[model samples]
Target chain A: MSAGTGDSVSLAAAGPILFDLVAVIVREQGRLSEIDGQTGDGDHGVNMGKGFRMAGERLRAQGEFTLPQGLATLGDTLLSDIGGSMGPLYGTFFTDMAEALDDTDRIDAPHFAAMLKAGLAAVQGLGDAKPGDKTLVDVLVPARDAFDAAQREGKSFADSLAVMKAAAEAGLEATRDLVAKVGRASRLGERSRGTLDAGAASCTMILSALADGLVQRLHA
Target chain B: MNRIINDPEQVADDAIRGVLLAYPDILAATDHPRVLRAAKRRGEGKVGIVTGGGSGHEPAFLGFVGAGLCDAVACGEIFASPTAKSFHEAFKAADFGAGVACLYGNYAGDNMNVKMAVKLAAKDGLEVRTVVANDDVASAPRAERDKRRGVAGEIMMWKAAGACSDEGGDLGQVIAVAQKAIDNTGSVGIGLSACTIPAAGKPNFTIAPGMMEVGIGHHGEPGIAVMPVETARGMAGLMMDRILEDQTFASGDDVAVLVSGLGATPVMELYILYSHVDAILRERGITPRHRFVGNYFTSLEMMGASVSVTRLDGELDRLLAHPAHSLGLTVLGR
Candidate 1:
């Protein structure tokens, strides 16, 4: 279980990671909606909470879901049940990540990096948003790139996860200064500034929770 | 939230259920529960017209589903876009050999959902075209017309496209007519109060008792200006002035006008506003060829109204005169 043992947590051991992500979304639901209320319609948190809660319930019912299995369930719930822009975006994200790690029981640094890249691609493929569009892509692109950079620099999986979380937080913070260019807030133009994007904020929370869960499970 | 509903989270679902019960003759449920298709199918070669938006704008995204109108509608959550799957389902429901035309507003969620839905439909070998309505004049400058929001004017777009489809136009022709309708239209909303999403349990935004937000959006998005509430005449003049400024309505030009109450506004007030609107149009020598004044489009229980004016040509005039049947709007003939 040493950092350099090339060790990996079993996919079954990673199910709680999605549970952690769901908890994070549920806790921040009000804050996320308040942020959205500043510019766009304030339903981001409600929709995210509803989707994540549904996924959590399904996962709990399964009792022994694997990482990819849990991710697939969550993605399916969001894609099919949730009705918002964030649903398909994050649904595709988790679905792609699940597919990327489907064949792997060992979640090594390279494999994790590949998963992050796949999730990022899935989000960008569905949304026309770029990094500066003040949308979830801003957090996702940077977080994915940071993880890849840490991996390329020969960092441990734990250290790469730390880097990803930090980058995601910073990306989320940067959205406060950005004028929305893609979502409903984009209609506000300059009025969209001075507020954090609800999507980016929720995305950062999910990414951070995910990173923390992975780090704790690295030695399990 | 002091409202009628079975479940707070299921407000949209319950409302849709009620819509189905109330209008079974005009509406039919598709494979996807969120998608409501017209009961009467179009002719064999006629294009299928489709539109969708978030719920709470009743008689809008769903109420417009009927013969000679939108063939199908993808119903979203209270104020959220419908899932891409729902949009795809609507496409399937509307597709009948002839290609489908998706006529909807220019909102980010709708745009993304429709984009994915089109991709999904393409996988199923269904051809779907789209015409996005961006007629809210105050939402963006003329230079950024594509960035504007589509408000009540979306009804006009659907009407024109549906008429085109009923006339046996192809998908491209329907899309073209819908686009023309929106492009020639300008809309502006004035909000006297805010509406609450039942789930949220409170209004998303606020307007002071004596103040009104001019150019407000459907979902309580901030408007261009906040001013003291004015009489119906004054409000009509302000809204019409903004709409007229956005587009040129020349002397003797035929125009179709729609004055829609923003949910809680009474029909009496809407007609009062429309009287001023009609007077202003007459003073400017802009003939009101077709006029619709009612709660045609609404935003939950927000107390407000929107004015939409579409400059019409011979083709558009014909489309306006064409027959339509829907819960929200119905026209017999010239």
Candidate 2:
């Protein structure tokens, strides 16, 4: 993805990079399930890994995908195959993110920020969970905000991505001390404390993988 | 354990194949593998009735698809919600020009999936309405009833909604009846053992050999209390007390009682438990207008049973008595 040796990347060439994200989820499936087992049914890994792998295989077979096309394909696969709440939740998230970039040819800090915000908004619209509810929101809100803050500070796109990833990690860690107020884990109430939220963990992994992919492809 | 499955991950998919094979006359496959429609479609202008949820409940989601029951169903993985695409497909399959009424349990996944599916269906110009069933009184306190997980009581909601739709009720009428059915119902379960999700390869939760969990959910979600195993009468009395406390079923009230085994339990045991439930209702001057005793809705192999009672009025009574046919339940003209 060429950015004229400047601060943006070409959305046309950013598709294949998502394969890296698929690999991350597939690789960490076990760990994700283990974390969920502490407070949930422990199938988070199996379900998320299954959806991501399916999307990855389909994209590989299709031979080419623009960033928006790839993300849309991934979102559609998850929405179709994964039946859990995750199917709709993450499905809408990526699908909405893809929609935000539909008319854009290049991805810059502002464009990236908009995509992140669209994804987060889609999730919030579907579920009633807020930031401290020990869900992906915990990671997603902070990640998007950090990226926006860094961009407003006039930081480079790469530095903004790093800041976003760090904020996502911090948000994920913050869930361990919070009582779950939504989802299946919320049934545990106080017992849910001390366990890293499975959704938050998955979100962090996704955001980290995304940031790394964008950083690698940023020509400047 | 010794599960007869080809691939653990494909269990849900394979089970659908088997169900289709066994009930070819009653059900037909949709474009989506996870959605099924009734073999005999109804005429246009009548509101369509649809219901769906995670699979392992067997007769629940799919079995309910028949002539006078759900027009279509979206099947999910065991103890999981069906995908939004699947739900949208189900809505399309069920729609016959008068809009579709989506009736389902109040689970987090199902709620999210259904919401997305409704949005998708709306985009396609197909109107889809929904009624979420939350009749398991033991899952949450009375003040938090909305947060309760739907259990066997969902059957009553479906039966009423199905009857209403079959009688040519409009979309709003179908939705209102479904909501009223669930509102007049309450359910609670006693789990004696745990069941495994084929993909998971092990039991997700466990119960002691000599102990039982009261108010346990279909997926082994923890309930209100855990105590030593009790007699059939004892279990019936305990479950009934919780339900009556949640809903004011006073003397002279008429109700429909359904006792469903949680998969592994025998039919004889369900009747044994139902006998006590019937006796308790009669003793309280509450008449049991209808009784459904069997494995209507179930967990994979969890050893337990749930009791559901719907306080019936003139409308609910007439609706419940309406003839219907499905693999999970069947009613003949009375």
Candidate 3:
């Protein structure tokens, strides 16, 4: 597994890459639910875990699949099996990302950035939340911006991913200070402040996992 | 935690199964397990009526499926909106030839899922329109009424849309009536205690024993204010004040009233509350043309009650009187 092949991970390994993402969600289910309980119905973890686990099971049975195929599978699973705002939000995110990466054989910095942008656009369009609404958009916008900025500055793919992960972490923490202006928590007003939005927390974890998985698969 | 169920995670699924077993004659299974259609199919060319939301609101979203109500329902996890796939499937199940009219509450999840479902239905050449109920006046200010969340007043919206569809209203007409129904309606709730999500294993929020949450949402979303628990009469007066303040009911106007127990509250208590509500309406010179008091919509095991009033005109009054049959509601013909 030592680096030697190329500067990008082959899209052929999408199955394993996505499985890792699913693992992260499964592991953090309890934490996500706890955060959501603070200002939401508290089913985010259970619903997200259920949908991811279903996709994980299918991926395991499939054994081998392209990155686009894997992303579509996960996206469709969430959109169809999970009911809630997350279902459509994340569903559109992954599904649109898959569509952006469709027909691509390998993921490089430019290709990855496009996928991120696509997912962000689709989610933003669907949820109608802005950058500071204390939703997942809080994390997504910053993370994507950081990645694009790093790439534009001519940073290496791995370095760009590192910055993206860092920005995502910062973005997630920022939600703790912002008041929710949309979604279920908006009704909570000032009470919604001081708590990390569940969507932002989960989004950070997802972005971190994706960055780590891609960095590990990068070759010299 | 002491719930009658198998796995806490499977509560929603298991409940759906039980519903099918108990009301096989009233509801029929759809292609997707999460979707259910009415058993007694109406004639072709009638506008289809569909609604969906999270589970745990027993007989709601699902129980409302029958001859003159929702033709199909998409069920989601407890207090979560139904999946886009389920919504699309429910739309399919309900549609016979004419377009489908989706009547649902104004929640982020439901809104997004219904939007996606509408897109999917369009691909299948089926037309779908939606009317989001935002009758919980306390959820938002009058200037931002569009932002308020839907509450028990959803039942009123459903009844109106279903009756319009049954009476052979076009999709536009049905949507217009449903929109009008919710726009003319106002609702408010008071939470005396918190309810636990089965999977969460504990109450997400709490209401002090001596205090109550005014304008509490169905899923325990924080209300506008928390104050000392008032007597049944006082509580009724407070709730009436909120609703009346949001929507005007002129003297001698006819209105439909609904009093729903939030799961843990007893029906006897609801009746107690209703007595005061009735008296208040009479004092205002408003006639309660139709009244429903029971657990029409509930937030699983939450001890509370919500009051809803929908002003009626000749059309809405006739629609409310239209004979309808469903697990959660039934109206006899004139």
Candidate 4:
């Protein structure tokens, strides 16, 4: 999204990119909290931001490593980060992604898809959600599935993952109709129906960022 | 909005810092985000306990972390279960030769997240066992108690777990002891007015004035029924009657009772509800072994309270009576 290429970007490029991404999530958490506040206990964006800021600082200090290195950094940062619910959900995403792409300098489409799958499985393992739980999975689950579908249709890595971004966007949009079945929003019953889930929105942002990075790299 | 917070996104971090600020002597921050544990694992050769969950449940997941209770608490953001990595970090900080027990409320996110964390830790050769508190009777029927939400009943579970650890029991024994408490517990909650989350700048719900929702959850769960507002006495009777419908407690049964405030409920009102609760239980000839009243598990300042009754055997009474040193609860003095 910075218009700077995301392909084969050095850890230097990746570090700042990671920082920016983390910062966005951190900042967006407040906005997310507001949406959830309509039906949840609030504190969405704040915790989300907190978790990412922790990851960002780690990246700033030690993010100059390889892709796997950066991912492991993110994983460790996420695991220990205490901001809130997103800590593990996002943390699992990074940790699984790290494991999936252990040390690749730049990942192609197949590996990228594998990373996405692993991240999805990790989140599912945490049982933080199903597709309509109105949490991050609402966005991530669909995005991952769409990426898989597009890849199966023989779309190029760049084109297929591009669909992932759209899927994530659509997933985030779909949250507006989902009455929360979990977390604080579930308590509000009908009141929860009107708002888009904060986690879902953030999940879309994360996937979209990854898509932006991949498209830049693959196209270039 | 009207929240007593610095920024919307910084709430959990700021509040976590405040927690460290409040209990400098007992809890210490870890390298991970938002995680705090006892400054040191017991050099005392005692078993260690680790408990945590989403932020905002205050005095709950973290406040219960101290000498006689949990050695570590992995604080996640409010309402979101903590990640597995954070949960594993807590296990390392708290594990003693006696093994570690991961205790928490049985919410879906926390359950799955902590499960992954504990699994990772076990791979590292740490003896880890998982125990969840699921005691809210209002969320499901008696035949389906396992599927109920873990509301105010978590307190009793933590208390029992901490007490077992304090008595120097092995981790398995501690978990077994906690299992007993969880098996005997039942809880019900009600909401008079919906709560407002600070950052969101709007109420989480909009219940009409003079109307109350019955069987509301700790995180502001939807109630089974919402109707005209009932008096404290009527509300107490309603909650008690519903809870007792399963005959969880019989005449002459000794019990440990909890009257918990859901975020915004005033203590004065909680006491009012308690008086009626005690009266209702008394009419059924139940003897309260102990009683606790206060805001334990919250819903981001929602106005509600839950009543929980755990039929107490002697072991549970002792476990409840063990010395506790936490931020919100510290009568143990040790």
Separate clash counts for every candidate: 0, 1, 0, 17
Which candidate comes out best when scored by DockQ?
3
Please provide TM-scores computed only on chain A for all of the candidate models, following their numbering: 0.95, 0.97, 0.96, 0.87
Model 4 ranges with Cα > 4 A deviation: A1-31, A57-69, A128-154, A171-195, B1-45, B66-68, B78-86, B298-300, B322-327, B330-334
Model 2 ranges with Cα > 4 A deviation: A1-6
lDDT by residue (B37-136, candidate 2, tens digit) is 9999977998888889998998888998887789999999888999888899999998899999999999999999999899999999999999999999
| Candidate 3 lDDT tens digits, B63-137 | 899978889999999999999999999999988899999999999999999999999999999999999999998
- Give the winner by DockQ: 2 or 4: 2
DockQ, candidate 2, vs. native dimer: 0.74
**Which tens-of-lDDT digit does each residue in B253-279 have in candidate 4?**
999899988888888999999999999
lDDT of 4 by residue, A100-205 (tens): 8765555766677788889889877765467777777887778878888987998877778778888888888888888787665665556677788877877777
All candidates' TM-scores? 0.96, 0.97, 0.98, 0.84
Q: Write the per-residue lDDT of candidate 3 for residues A1-220, one digit (tens) a residue.
A: 4332445777885447898889999999999999998888787898889999999999888888988888889998999899788999999899999998876788888889999999999999998899899999999999999999998899988999999999999999999999999998898889899999999998999898888888777863
lDDT of 1 at B310: 98
| Predicted structure 4, TM vs. truth | 0.84
Fill in the DockQ of model 3.
0.88
Off by over 4 Å in 3: A1-6
Candidate 2 lDDT at A46 equals 89
- Model 4, DockQ value? 0.39
lDDT per residue for candidate 1 within B1-334, as digits (tens), equals 6687878889888888898899889999877889999989886777888889899998888988887789999999988889888999999888888999998888877888899889999999999999889999998889998888888888888988888888788877888899999999999999999999888778868999999999999998788999999999999999999988889888898999999999999899999999999999999999999999998889999999999999999999999889999999999988
> Evaluated on chain B only, what is the TM-score of candidate 2?
0.99
RMSD of each: 1.9, 1.5, 1.3, 4.2
